[model samples]
Target chain A: MQLPFSLQPLFDFLGQFTDGPANALIIVIALIKIALIVGGLLQIIPFIILFERKIISWVQDRPGPNRAGPWGLLHGILDGVKLFFKEEITPKGVDKPLYLLAPGLTVAPAFLALCLVPVGPIIQGAHLDALVSFLRLDPSIIGPGGIISEIPLAITNPNIGILYVLAVTSIGVYGITLAGWSSNNKWSLLGGIRASAQMVSYEITLSLSIIGVVLLAGSLNLYNIIDSQAGGFWHWNVMAQPVAFLLFIIAMFAETNRLPFDLAEAEPELTGGFHTEYSSMRFALFFLGEYINMVIVSAMCVTLFLGGYHGLFPLPWEAIATWITNISPSFAGFYPWVIMASYLIGPMVIVPAKVGFFIFLFIFARATLPRLRYDQLMDLGWKRLLPIGLINLVITSGIIAIDLMVTGNGQVELATKWIIGAITLGLFLAWDLLYYSPRRKAQLEKDYRLYPKSAKKGEKPALAS
Target chain B: MLVDFLKGSALALKHMGNFIIGKGNVTLEYPEVKREQPAFFRGRHRLQRYRDGLERCVGCSLCAAVCPSEAIYLEAAENTDENQVSAGERYAEIYQIHLLRCIFCGFCEEACPENAIVMGASYELAMNKRTDFIAEKDDMLDPAEKGFGDYHEYDPYISHVTPESDKSAKGDPWAVKAEH
Candidate 1:
């Protein structure tokens, strides 16, 4: 009763009147779940677009889009609608067939990657006392002998989920590749080449960076990995393997081709990169794909480092599980429809809302940072992140070994070592912050002093006040 | 080396809380928190005048010509004996700096023949539309007597040694002027 119900009353009314409790619950859950994702995306996509504009403007010391909807969040909406209505102009000389197909290529793989994401607790696993069971088994993930018998909210609990993610991510390159190559434009070709090289280059490091996670989790399935973090913040990968988190975040940025890493379509040179010739819905799809990929990468980051769908505070997830299990007998007496409705909506609505917060973080980041150049991107992957990732892997292995030797348990439990982990993470972040601050200041000073007057050859001189 | 590295890292960790979340950011929010702009910071363009009340700009389109972004516009008019604004034969009548297009490169300041235009620290030029940004001569003209001149009231010749330099140079009777 203290649920402070938003959608609860509506489900209750539906159960009492037309449908049975069981069926009505399932229907309500299913409908709400779909609404949550679509609604969140519509809002998240637009605001992120506006936020990016605002951030970029401040970086270059200019005012960005702020005239559309409240604080110009509707600018992306305006863009989307305009792109949809505007002419889907297919240039005459281009390969019309592939050009049409290219945008979809960008979008589909992101959705595929999202399919494996565990947004919330699969209730069966959380509450072991279960009358109702929802267990999905894929041999590819859990292995041949291993069988996880549980009830969950995920669409499909694939065993080999991590591998599936890596494979699907690699597939996203095809969309950009097709868009660039099929366009028959020179800029498009250049964009495709750059994207292929960058995406391919980063994919190697990205996969390698997450190897530490796989080693630690000992399972590819995201559910098991999430469950491992059930112990709390200290158990979170962010603390234990900070270097891996760093590499993973950077790689994901490159993988998604966002700012600083977005040389593929830096606008002035590439003129919108691979999808330059695209127009109308096709163009919109590519745009949507970019944002979706951004969300997916952020989601993946949360999945690996932040506890995926697990709340920071412990009050609610346990309470919800108790409430769900108690209502089971009442569902049995009621009609099928009521019980079914509850089954679907409970997870669907709850899941997306949780996922939306991480998505917001991604948008926040895009709003705040600048894009990197191609060479700098290479240097980071090869020199910095890769080496650090390796060093971290070695150090973590040593820690795990020492823990096993002392306690006779291979597991490095956070309850005992959280302070140490926190200190280690705190120290590293501080050093980086202090070390980079001076260098960054000096480099920026050099750039400013040597720009415009002394070196106006390649640089677009800053316009006079 | 290992122990030293650990110690250095631990020191960083100890003070980390004071940095990212606390107030250790090097970046000053411009026009809001207001960074201390350099004295020669070339920002918004403003018109100039000589000490003797004659306009410093000699109807020269050098700023407009040398502008990389082509941001400045100047229309020179001849200074007649009756209606002379400047010491030179000609004076700028319709001078405009399109703030929207201005790149802040200081080229307009650099290319000035008479040193009539110099980059100032007036960085607060944010506007809503393109039209609002087109700063006219009236906005840029130095308010000499109203005490808003480029090197206003204060004696320019005085270094840090002269504590009383903030006072007006009214003793030099030629420096007296009306507001622009």
Candidate 2:
């Protein structure tokens, strides 16, 4: 039976866009989505500042900057103004050039990481056909591939999309390292060293935990992963990969340098850390840069594992999308709806929901959790999350093997997601029940020191001969 | 074993009182319930205006000169016979106290020969702007009549509280304004 022209037009347009009303609308929505997500981030960063102040104050049981704007928002702005005019103190014996360059280095990566984050529902709207006839191009000379595919709003949507996130985020450490080194102070050196060590140790676990998500998704392209989970509810990674989710969220807090992890400028004691010697606006840059890093991590967490901007859950996407197309012209014309729901709904609804959730989670954690002693932080990274990553992978591989053995294929295996979740919950309880006890932690440290080196237990401790 | 557990329970209850009922040192709900401030309390400072609306400060550089912490910085312009603003020969055209540097010693108050400047009780001096702390005479002055009675209106300068109530009942005459 010949499928009629109206249906044919919709599918044909979608399969290969002719820069029609639909395609143009999709492009415009993508650009608007980009602007909205980025703009929301710029506006949200200040409130995160307020959120941080309020939460910290509450934790300490004191009022924070309450005088500025309603809740000290004006104070944050006032602080910025003060920074601009206040003496830009340059420390003695500091490297004048790199000292200046370092703060921006930490900040720029934050915006870059936000670029791929999906934040709004993809509303079908006016999109310009970016493809155009160029005066210089001879169609004959221009190879088929030489012509650009319609340039998507994303800088690039490569198969290795999230690999870019991992690579770029690690680059943020350089800024802190340089700031610490360039300042030429002992405290800065100590701070830079700790930041480097913490970030480097955790990056491995952070990247590894997300691999569990990547494994579950079975692809690296962020848009494709998001696209695969379009419509109603349950298909998002949170339920499926609970352990990986926990690991990722924890590592994210550490990565962003939110409190407990905010030892970088653990003031009064740190006396401003690496920027202690910094005066005026030069120091203010470092301060804003820290907040920017927090924004980047918060945004990434929203996009990754949380379905970017998917609604609470997606129903069996293929079934729903297929049924709608069959049932009504309601779904007939809008190919972009599937993409737009994620683009529009996820970001407008889900991303903000997730970002708010995580920021609160961050505040709650700071209020509840005392900082890990420096060594303990390093241990959690190298000894704990790293091993857990390997164990998770082994179990995942074993599940894949079982699914292959039982079904004779590795595709779409139903592994024991419940068991994995239980195990993850058990480990978290163990961490809280065991490692979370400060008295126990202190005792353990004392005992650890008391126990002599195993290799040299029998020998007298060797003097520095 | 029962006794040990009971002892632990007793200890826990004691701690529970401390944790739940309150910390032993409960902070007062401030503003509504302020503690009686210390004997030598410094809450807010006011610059005095005379009965004829003249200032008492003579533009003698002594306050700035004598300030050991260099917290006080002053500049003077002579008040000639044609335009006399102060009872003294001079009035301070520019007087600044760098509170950031101030040790809060009453040295500048003591250095005034005319018994002009006195540190008052304004601890509400938090500043988001450094320029705010520069505090021109207008920001600092008492704006009160020279008569003994004007001292304690909620503010002699800008009293939301009656300046009379605002005044400490008694202290050094220079520091405290007396009601006529």
lDDT values of the candidates? 0.65, 0.63
**How close is candidate 1 at the interface, in terms of C-alpha RMSD after superposing the true interface residues?**
11.5
What's the TM-score, to 2 decimals, of chain B in model 1?
Answer: 0.65
Fnat, one value per model: 0.00, 0.00
Please provide, for model 1 over B1-180, each residue's C-alpha lDDT reduced to its tens digit, 9 standing for 90 to 100: 224435654544444334434444345544457654434345667676655566767778989999988988899999998997876789999888888788889887767766677665566788888798888887887654422233223333211111233222334323212222
Task: Tell me the TM-score of chain B in each candidate.
Answer: 0.65, 0.64
Q: Return the lDDT, model 2, position B73.
A: 69
lDDT of 2 at A449: 67
- What TM-score goes with each of the models? 0.57, 0.61
Question: What DockQ does candidate 1 score?
Answer: 0.03
Q: Evaluate residue A48 in candidate 2 and report its C-alpha lDDT on the 0 to 100 scale.
A: 77
**Model 2, total clashes:** 44
Question: Mind giving the per-residue lDDT tens digits that candidate 2 earns over A72-169?
Answer: 77776676778889977777898988888888888777667767664543321222111122112222222233333333335345678788878888
What's the lDDT for residue A16 in model 2?
A: 65
Chain A TM per prediction: 0.72, 0.73
What lDDT tens digits, residue by residue, belong to model 1 across residues A1-465?
112334434545776874544456555545554465545565667667776665445433445566677667779889878887898888878777777777887888887776666666664432322222222222221222223344355545688888998898888888888888888899988888888888987887787767767766768998887777765566677766676676787788788877657777778889999889888899888878888887777777888877676655434433455466668875443332334444444345534554465555454445444566677777777776666666666666666666667887655567433533454466667756775676775675566464444546777787432
The 10 consecutive residues of candidate 2 chain A with the worst lDDT sum are: A126-135
